[model samples]
Target: MAEYKPGEMDISVQEKTFDGFISMVTKGAILCILVLIFMALVNA
Candidate 1:
């Protein structure tokens, strides 16, 4: 296997971390919206 440079590896790691964080935030936001809608429906 080929070896990666420190700077390149750092950037790759950061990109992956950012992507994962964004994904989790998106999922959490969707879940919150769904829950709010459900609660409103139940109340109405």
Candidate 2:
């Protein structure tokens, strides 16, 4: 059986996926904010 070791496993893929997720969420939030501002300006 393999021994368990903390902080010894590769997490490059997980880090990349998380970074992409964060970037997507940030962009989506910015787009929503901009749309809200536009709607408010137009009195919609």
Candidate 3:
């Protein structure tokens, strides 16, 4: 087994938060783009 280092857990937590934030932003962007496309199609 690998030795556990101090502060490693904190880094992992931060990484998870960062990943979640990025995922949320990406999803929001995709949703906005999809809505725009749908609106354009309806208006056309």
Candidate 4:
């Protein structure tokens, strides 16, 4: 078995996936807020 080395693993893909997740969450939150505002204005 090979010994493990700290900080030697490649994580570019993980970083990209996490960034995309954060971006999607941010956009979804903004859309939800906008929808809520519209609904409130329309008394729904």
Model 3 RMSD in angstroms: 5.1
Error in Å for residue 25 of model 4: 0.5
TM-score, prediction 4: 0.90
Instruction: For residues 1-44, write the lDDT of model 1, one tens digit per residue.
Output: 89967765447878899999999999999999999999999999
> TM-score for all predictions?
0.77, 0.89, 0.78, 0.90
RMSD of 2: 1.2
The residue-by-residue lDDT of candidate 3 on 1-44, one tens digit each, is 99988865657878899999999999999999999999999999
Which regions of candidate 1 deviate over 4 angstroms?
A: 1-10
Instruction: List the lowest-lDDT window of 10 residues for candidate 3.
Output: 6-15
Which candidate achieves the best TM-score against the true structure? 4
Better of 2 and 3 by lDDT: 2
Better of 3 and 4 by TM-score: 4
Residue 41's lDDT within candidate 4 is 94
Against the reference, the lDDT scores of all candidates come to 0.91, 0.98, 0.93, 0.99
Clash pairs, candidate 3, are none
After TM-score superposition, what is the CA distance of residue 17 in candidate 1 from its true location, in Å? 0.1
lDDT of 4 by residue, 1-44 (tens): 99999999999999999999999999999999999999999995
Candidate 2 Cα misplacement greater than 4 A, ranges = none
RMSD vs true structure, all candidates:
4.7, 1.2, 5.1, 1.3
lDDT of 2 by residue, 1-44 (tens): 99999999999999999999999999999999999999999995
Cα TM-score of candidate 3: 0.78
**What lDDT is obtained when candidate 3 is compared to the true structure?**
0.93
Positional deviation of 11 in candidate 3, in angstroms?
A: 0.3
